[model samples]
Target: MLFTYPIAATADNWVSTTLLELLKNAVEYLQNAQEPDGFQESVPEEYQAEFARGTKFPDLYAAFVDQCRLLNDQQRDLVLKALAGQNGFPGLFAANTPCPNITVTLQAVNQATRSLFEYAFGKLSDLKTPGSVDTVRARYHQLVHSHIASGCCPFCGLEILEAPDPDLVDPDLDHYLAISKYPFAGANLRNLTAMGTTCNRSYKGAKDILLNELNQKVDCIDPYGDQLITISLAGTVLLPGGGQGPAWVLSFDPDALSQNWRRIFKLETRLQANVLEKQYQTWLESCVKYAQKNGIDISLKEGAIEAVRKFRDTCEYETFPAIARLKTNFFELVEAELNDPQDGDRMHNFVAAVQAA
Candidate 1:
């Protein structure tokens, strides 16, 4: 993202305005800054408008107006910075591309709406009994969500059909605040994802845990948040023998991270098939030599080929650590080959060197 100028402050005097009006103004500005090709430009002006409507104002109307003013300035600065286009936005909240601006805008709107509702409800809660706090909180939550169904899901990154699924029931809104602290992701519509209620309970707030296990800082990929394509199935694996089976691996692409050694693993598939073919050819040559030296009565080549085939065909995720260690050792051996100067034969100069000697 880029910025042409800093966000300028607004005047102290404020006016009364409805939340609808605030949103209307924000939409208009966004529409104006939108490119002909449909890409949006950052505009901090909307934030200024929101800040002008802060709760400290004398009455509800005055507060909303001031909040809008702050929102206006903030939105304008965001626009200018985003337009400069230097800082690449993270590809979260969508499958293949970044929707930073869209998500940010939604977050802004969500936050503003939440603040307004909280102010209204918190004031009411202050007059009630202590036991009613939970009830009031629930009502406030309901009120917040009342405006949510009208929104869109920011988590899935793209529009999803309103179909009932166990994964999507009682969807809770989520936002990828690691990128931008926008509230747009908190609405059930924008952040709603369907999961079994039980799964949701288990996976709720597991983002931090997953991050730690990953051992690297990678952005989440959501239609509106982050991109995480691979998930561990260590706990999901089950067997009929009352014990866990081998760990199963799942990914949008099985071949993903073939180059990233840190997350690489092994399984029986086409790549392994190819590797097996090469390994068996080498084993065939090795076995032939071994039989010649020992004068073996049996067909050692056949046995060696069979062993290689079995190793390749039955390779599973559990065997990855050992296989990968071997791979690493082989890599080191190759590095040694390249670094050594004693092996003229290895560099294809043996014919001339032998004649000269």
Candidate 2:
């Protein structure tokens, strides 16, 4: 996938200033709700009484607030560091800091944070009101549609343009670190990212991106970081039973994290869908049409290579980048065949047959 710009740097602009103010207010509210022995009283009376009643988990709220209060300045800084997409904080917190002895589960803290996040941002319907604060979901939708993604899902490079509704059009925000697992980072800006709903809800549901099998934090490529993932077509083979010309196998460099990313998103399998194959076939047909219109004889090796190169270059900035990369790599394979003296004649004949078809 193409690299993503830093989200933390840009997130502040989209998030309403009122939301930050509300967060500070919520913190104060939590602090006031706590008693001397780390138990909470009922919530403030200003909120709707029924809503306030639901929030009154005295011990759980107290434990969550106490955990935050117990953090030293350095540890607090680490919290901010994790929010900025840096590594080391998760592991440090898990290993060094022990949860206080209270009836609070980490899941409770996560749920509380999520509730606070929603309250501060307001509801989705509230976002349409003139001066109401923008919800986190709304801000993330804006970030995805206007900045990171356009006509398709950025993570899978699939054209998800079937719906016209803004909510349906916009991709889902997958918490890169599962919010259920990392409660402290639930509202951290950098942890949120736009992904296809299928990838987020179906394939990568609640999976931990930061932690390893040993439960130690291992660094994965943050989509918001400067690192770029390169997807290429590894090879193609004609399958005896398939109707299509050949099945292309895609590969990625920097395989460690890239492979993990692929597995998490099910990218290879997603890209191999019948619709995508049809799209690829259509793209190939366009190249042949262009060659014919320009009076270029693609029956020759050099001519076929030139036509493929032109098509590949044209697709570089298109909406579906995965297709562009695949096409580029496919052309490179053709170029290799043309350069080999032994295979050159056979490759030329293959092109002639494709052109005639």
Candidate 3:
């Protein structure tokens, strides 16, 4: 939720709008059907639209309606209406918001709509013209690369963010409100953005952020919205769980949003492995070098004590956000330890660790 990329700032993507138009047409036809099974295999000439110049939108929407054939007239209409709305993403994702509680009777509709949208999603990348500069994918790449300046993923700030490279791998376009759980948002770019492979696969995969498995609901911060989080060292503990040297206590702003974000991404656990464990010793070594370069004398206990402030002063100021976040919390912990008489054990431990390196 601390992610800074603004999805709301971006205009409606033309390609997404075009795909959405097809979805609207398909859903409207089903909603207007005189009976649940009255629809034809293909649409009428006027209702047909080309997804791209040569690719037909296909005779697929009727197949989804077929899945819902056992449903009554009112149930069928409820299912179709669920598929038609896409503009609710912004409000639905905002803090304290709850998705409409569709009952189990509408389950067939949910499955059918999800299937239809995902089928459409497969063609999104091809919605562009050959070598056309004025295309949605090109614009998406430009905006993403520009806004995600550190090249770090907004989801966890733990990996590089890049546009799709033909010779290499492409980043996953993650739906903030995952399509598996929500009916209306599968193709909406407002509900979608780039995500790191680890964040997408290992952490937030197919999990319903809005309503967990226990059926509890909470509002999640929009990845593209302005509600941002900051990292800080709340405190440090010596011999955490009676085994470790030290461990970080992290916090985020706007208390309401942090809980769900933390839960979904497992921020603390991953940051510990990827950032803290990996970087702690290197940061300590850098502090020692800083002390040596600045001629901060550390020959005696008091002299070594004098170097804590200088050590804390040299935390890395890099473009990578996770590194920057680590430095902020790590150095603050070091300074706080040195300032406390009760924390002399950690203070001396830090001095020994850095100076030894």
- Local accuracy by lDDT, each model: 0.31, 0.54, 0.63
TM-score of model 3 relative to the true fold? 0.81
Model 2 regions lying over 4 Å from their true place: 5-10, 13-136, 149-151, 160-170, 212-217, 234-249, 273-282
Best model number under TM-score: 3
Query: RMSD, each candidate, Å?
Result: 19.2, 7.1, 4.3
TM-score of 1: 0.28
- On the 0 to 100 scale, the lDDT of residue 278 in model 1 is 37
- Model 2, global lDDT: 0.54
lDDT tens string, model 3, 1-357? 546665633563554455445555545555666443222323333323334232423434555656655566576566545544334656776545546534376766667667666865665555553345434444565577777777778878878876546665657778777787675677666777778898898888887777644667777776777777877667656336454666666667766667777878888888877788788877777766776787875544455556656665554456677777777667666666666787655576657766875
List, residue by residue over 1-357, the lDDT tens digit for candidate 2. Answer: 455634643354222233323333434544555434322223233333323333433444454455556544554343333323322333332423332211133334345544444442333323332343554456555555555544566567654522335545545656676655444444445556666677678887887665545654444665666567887666665232345456677677776666556766777787777434666556667778888988887877788877766766776666566666666666666666656797766666665666778
TM-score of each: 0.28, 0.66, 0.81
Ranking of predictions according to TM-score: 3, 2, 1
Clashing pairs in 3: 7-224
Is 1 or 3 the stronger prediction by TM-score? 3
- Which window of ten consecutive residues has the lowest lDDT sum in model 1? 1-10
Q: Pick the candidate with the highest lDDT.
A: 3
